[model samples]
Target: MTKIARRTEKLTEALRRAGVRITRQRAALLSVLAEAEDHPEAIELHRRAEAVVPGISLSTVYRSLTELENQGVILRHQFDGTPARFEHTETRHHDHMIDVDTGEVVEFASERIEALQAEIAEALGYEIVHHRFELYVRKKDGL
Candidate 1:
């Protein structure tokens, strides 16, 4: 199967495990979610899903997203001053940089930053369990 198909199947299975029936509309939403690269808000997701299969309500989108999130198949990011956005949990560990002006999110991973966080946690007599790091940035004037 293609990557998107595999991801959709995985999402479908997750929702099924969460006791959510996979209706045509919900399946469309799952397919859209699986194909998403950038974090998208619920309304954006609803719009996309509606294009694939009309008549999908925004409230249904929200409920399906909540169910997917609860099933640990997706992650929601509430960046400063923006509506909550979501991405599938299959992505590798990474931090985010949110463009303050454009509301764009960029993902990056750094071993140095991870190690530094671990060191800081150890110095405070604690072990790093889970953490989220985000940076708000704007484009340089000339760049």
Candidate 2:
């Protein structure tokens, strides 16, 4: 199965396990989130979801996001004081770098940074339960 199909299935199963009814509206929103390439705020998601199934309201999108997040099928991040963006959970861990000027997001990973985070947490006497990192950036002077 494709990535989209796999995510759709994950969301469906998670909802079922959580005892949340799988309505067509919820399923449609999950599918959109699953297939999305970049992190999209609620408005962007609502727009796309409406395109997929006409007449769906923004409120429905909000509720579905909240529920999916609670169910652990999605990850939501608020980067550099911007609106919250959502992504389907991925097995591999990564962090986001945001272009402040153009509002673009890029995913990146660094073992050195991960090790530093662990060291900091250990120094603080806290087992890193969970953490997320985001950096605001700008394009260079030239391409």
Candidate 3:
């Protein structure tokens, strides 16, 4: 199966396991979530899903997202001064940089930063369990 199909199936199975009935509208939303490459808010997701299958309510989208999040199949990011956005949990570990002017999210991974965080945690007499790091940035004047 294609990657999108696999992701869609994984999401479907997760919802099923969580006892959510796979309504047609919910299926469309799942497909949209699976194909999403950028973090999108619930309203954006609802709009996309509505394009595929009309009559999907915003409340339905919110409820479905809550169910999926509870199932641990997705991660929600509430960046500063923006609505909550979501991405699937299949992505590898990475930190985010949010553009202050455009609300764009950029993902990056750094071994050096990871090591430094670990060292700091050790010095503090604690082991790193889970963490989230975000940087708010703006474009340079000449860029």
Candidate 4:
């Protein structure tokens, strides 16, 4: 199934669904994003895209990312004070645990936590239409 997805769902197709026009530069940016596992900020994403599409500019990357986000093809997260990072929307839904010391992001999901959040929201006399959870963490000594 994953292999089929990799073969079928190019980022450009996603952009089209979001009403974005496809260009060579845009395709290159999407290619980089499709291969990325970790969240990457604009500069980092541009750097990676450069390898595939020479002469890609920083401004173009920013524009492409913004378009992708607006199209609902990508999701953004800001960890600590760092520049925002982006991930593809089709990936599994989960919360992020950032190792602030290393800037590493670990994705995790918990049914119990989800339930608790819903309960808390209801207790507060509101329902959760949408939410984001991110936990900043540090490694313990002699782990």
lDDT of 3 by residue, 1-143 (tens): 99899999999998899888999999999999999999999999999999999999999899989989999999999999799999999989999999999999999999999999999999999999999999999999999
Q: For candidate 1, give the lDDT.
A: 0.94
* Candidates 3 and 4, the one with greater TM-score: 3
Which candidate's TM-score is highest?
3
Residue pairs clashing in model 3 are none
The TM-scores, one per candidate, come to 0.97, 0.88, 0.98, 0.87
* Tens digits of lDDT, candidate 1, 13-126: 988998888889998999999999999999999999999999999988999899889989899999997899999898899999999989999999999999999999999999
Model 2, span 65-103: residue lDDT tens: 887889887888888778999887875799889999999
Best by lDDT: 3
- Score each candidate by Cα lDDT: 0.94, 0.85, 0.96, 0.82
Better of 1 and 2 by TM-score: 1
Off by over 4 Å in 3: none
Question: What's the true lDDT of residue 17 in model 4?
Answer: 74
lDDT of 2: 0.85
Residue pairs with backbone atoms closer than 3 Å in model 2 (clashes): none
What value of lDDT does candidate 3 attain over all alpha carbons?
0.96
lDDT of 4 by residue, 22-122 (tens): 77777777777877888888999999889888988898888878877886778889887988999878777699999989998999999999999999999
What's model 2's TM-score?
0.88
Better of 1 and 3 by lDDT: 3
